[model samples]
Target chain A: MATVAAKAGEAGIVGAAERLGVPLLTYAAADLAQVAVPNPSAAPLAAVGTPSVAEAAALLGAPGGELVVQKRKSAMATVAVARRRPRGRLALVGLGPGARDLMTPRAVAELRRASVVVGLDQYVDQVRDLLAPGTRVLESGLGAEEERARSAVAQARAGHAVALIGSGDAGVYAMASPALAEAGDDIDVVGVPGVTAALAAAALLGAPLGHDHVSISLSDLHTPWDVIERRVRAAAESDLVVTFYNPRSRGRDWQLPKALSILAGHRAPATPVGVVHAASRPDERAEVTTLAALDVTTVDMVTVVTVGNTASREIAGRMVTPRGYRWQS
Target chain B: MATVAAKAGEAGIVGAAERLGVPLLTYAAADLAQVAVPNPSAAPLAAVGTPSVAEAAALLGAPGGELVVQKRKSAMATVAVARRRPRGRLALVGLGPGARDLMTPRAVAELRRASVVVGLDQYVDQVRDLLAPGTRVLESGLGAEEERARSAVAQARAGHAVALIGSGDAGVYAMASPALAEAGDDIDVVGVPGVTAALAAAALLGAPLGHDHVSISLSDLHTPWDVIERRVRAAAESDLVVTFYNPRSRGRDWQLPKALSILAGHRAPATPVGVVHAASRPDERAEVTTLAALDVTTVDMVTVVTVGNTASREIAGRMVTPRGYRWQS
Candidate 1:
């Protein structure tokens, strides 16, 4: 809220408050000046007769409220969060597809803001330098996602700012599920989206995802093989471009080949298939091949395989799918 | 290549060049010193007899060549690009779902690197301040996607660094399709992936994309309604979460309702649905509702509707779908 309703409306303050389901409370210059804030400014005092609008207003509203978050400014507006007590913060941050620059600014900010970071060992190693000095990092080995989620929630419940990190979007086959499961309304949870492996591989292989597509992880560790195969068959029959995550490992090479065969049943053998390893990483590699010629032995846990739809094509060494429907002129 | 092969290998330069299928050329210090560069340093001259390693090596490798990109230094290395002739450069950048902080660092760098920026007028307005001081912007109104693509490609062909911007991941129903269609081998193209609408909406609504999911655009302006309906049906039957883009507009209000009905056939009426309007924007609004309670009239072109699968649930007012085949023990 602003001194004038028009200012609040034009500045989008009113709409933002409404979206957050919070009331828009405004105070007059004389009234705001009466509340003394820890952080006071001469500029605001001259303009609105108050050194701090956000802190003052929050304190006025919450009787004994404390500043949980100091004033942070963006290009458009200023934000300061206050609460009557210390609230735990949980940030599910996606580090993007292995590349440092691919990570969003919000994800980096969340990592810096957190007092504790919980993640897989490898993912934590990737962004250890990005963390703010003195951040407590709790890293675990692979296949312990649930444990890490529990630990993160526990840390947050202890009144710490916690960031649970994952490669790619944490919501997509990452840490978000277990973390959200362990969390309740007691903590403030924030999800910071990252570039998923499928999207990252698609960029390297060109625009294979230009049309409707589906991403299905090929790992059978959690999902039953029958269920996974059913999805593969459905994608093939539906003519949807398919991106397979956790395509293969030393002990599980057969799943990828089997999935490929299921897809081959519906798609032509000449269909364009993209195999990407460690996309955007130091050892990043990508190739566009056909289902019949791709070597399943070459794939590993770090790889992602994208099978194009019947309408997809490899043009100029890049896979592309037109956006229009097949019959569209 | 470096002064020594070990250095290049240790820095991952050799692997990166090999992955891109480019030759890694090397030059001795004396040979590199023969080439004159715009920026020279005394430190390099004292150590390697060359004032500039990157600029000198690039110039020495391509005889009679000129520097296209000047020497830029990071903490680990220096980079300089030289070509026999001026080569056109094109970067298809995804601006990510709406918030300025949500955009990737790579996407931001591409925008700053480009001499020309081509995008929709509204998207351009969102990032106007982020553009480099002298960037030449070519913004168009609605329904001119093809024109914008052509202009971006043309600018790249004219030997200018061009960035084509779009909301969300540019490859997913955005500018990547048309732009890639217009591009040829003549220009060097780079894709900087952004946070797509589906991912952005998913973040706001919790982990609905925790497992296999599909995104289908509901707009029939170019795609046939029959084709759109088929995808929706496939997602419904496959038990895949469905994210609908261009869900509704004033003119096309029936499609979302029709699509929802099709999804309702496979999922229960109590299935969770997430509706996010202008996600990450100032007017952002998100709600979790049941399929039966969702009002299609409340949706608009700027909205994204995510219909959760049979296993999805609204826990503590947040929509979440487990990744496991069944409920965890």
Candidate 2:
């Protein structure tokens, strides 16, 4: 897996460090050894701009000091941070869509190399050991909107390597928007894709995303109800192999049935839908059910509903939508 | 690299032939024995579904002109023709995307073992003796889509070991489709996914397909134009990183530019679009061009355009769309 190190590493900090011919500082001997001479110059100068009182102390390595200084730029021109890196590398590292081996090697490498890791409380614990010792970590557990952004921005500004991790591909409604909005322009963000739940489900029961497929999220937490409805209508009309994410949660169990109605047009009432829960993770479970037999209340946020394309059928015990080749044959 | 064996081998043909449960016959075999093969009963049978016309009449050793007949069941359970005594099996394969190293080991092994080979004209020519001789060969030239499929199906049905080939994932827009379509359902078709072009392009372009990406083809030769338009509209509205296949041709170059006007509402004109021509194959070229600068006429069928998500951008001559995460100072 070729790392999209981009400006995030090689041409960015490492390049600067190389040009200066100095070793970037690190508490870990591994990171330190990874560089040549320890370049103390890479160290933060005490009067660097944009030091909130708290941060000035941190940058100065002033232990136990918390002064409230105003936020300002860290360095003029030398460190023109993006609004946060437009391509702040994001690795949507899939822990599994269940077993770790199923996790692609690329996902493992990104996790091991990330400097600052930001993610949900669950993911932070999942691959905690992969982190290099002494790396700073910012864990957000159900924080308010601005709080998440503010924390992400502050860390990126700190010059510490940071990774905003998410289970599955972070781009799949898990990390893309919020992470982008918070990190600002100077930081380059890149999303690491993992095996998506739909792919796993398809693989488990033979290829399902074989032909024209569409993945839709049922929970309308952030999206307007009308938007969801319109998209579902459009997908159904297109006869797409649809996968519904965020199918149900506490108090949101009603989402599935409502989704069925919105998609009633194209799919026959008896269309096959595979309800997968805890995909690729321990306690993983999956069941094949038809659209008419689907019981939304039994599902939760962990469940991903895969509704087959118009061609899908229940064969034996599996719900499969042959990618048309079967019919062609 | 996984050899997505043609239907004849994958289902039960190989096993049957190995056990001498069925008869087998092949058209050409210059070197039939260097590799390990499970053998069977009588002479190889006629290839399935294809007419018993040209090849069978001219080359078959059977003095009685016996042709293998298929036992078709339900609409979907059909397989290719069955030989009376099958001596060997051939796997039609596709190595998705490029990066030869990414080729699946299974595909590599099968190719290594093939005594006789058949592939698209360019592929057969490119491999340069990837097969051992005296290997009989059938190279399908351009605009000979049906011809290639028929040849592969015919060869496999005859029971001579062969590997039908495709680049990138076999199941997605590769030889697997036509091979199975024309061959009867009784023929066993096994799909081994190589790296899909989208995944390879995404990996090359620094996580461009992170999060919600869509793989949409601009080709409307076999598919209806209206269907193509609807998918395009939905992908744009959903803000997906769209991968366009067969984006242009001599007569159909207008679709790409037309797609721009249709998708502009959802995607910013300045959004980063990576135009990759002949990905993975030698002479592969990729350019980080923005949608605004894209000239449909300049892009031909060889080109694959990834109209990035809202986050995609051109940075330092490379196309990148950050999944969103900023690193602090």
> In DockQ terms, which candidate is top?
1
Global lDDT scores for all candidate models: 0.85, 0.57
Q: Candidate 1 lDDT, tens digit per residue, A80-155?
A: 6677656789998999999889999999999989999999999999999988999999999987878898999999
Per-residue error (Å), model 1, residue A81: 23
Query: Ten-residue segment with the worst summed lDDT in candidate 1 chain B?
Result: B1-10
Q: Count the backbone clashes (under 3 Å) in each candidate.
A: 0, 89
Which 10 successive residues of model 2 chain B have the least lDDT summed? Answer: B32-41
Best by lDDT: 1
Error of 1 at B182 (Å): 2.6
Looking at model 1 chain A, which ten-residue stretch has the lowest summed lDDT?
A1-10
TM-scores for chain B, listed for all candidates: 0.75, 0.67
User: Candidate 1 docking category?
Assistant: acceptable
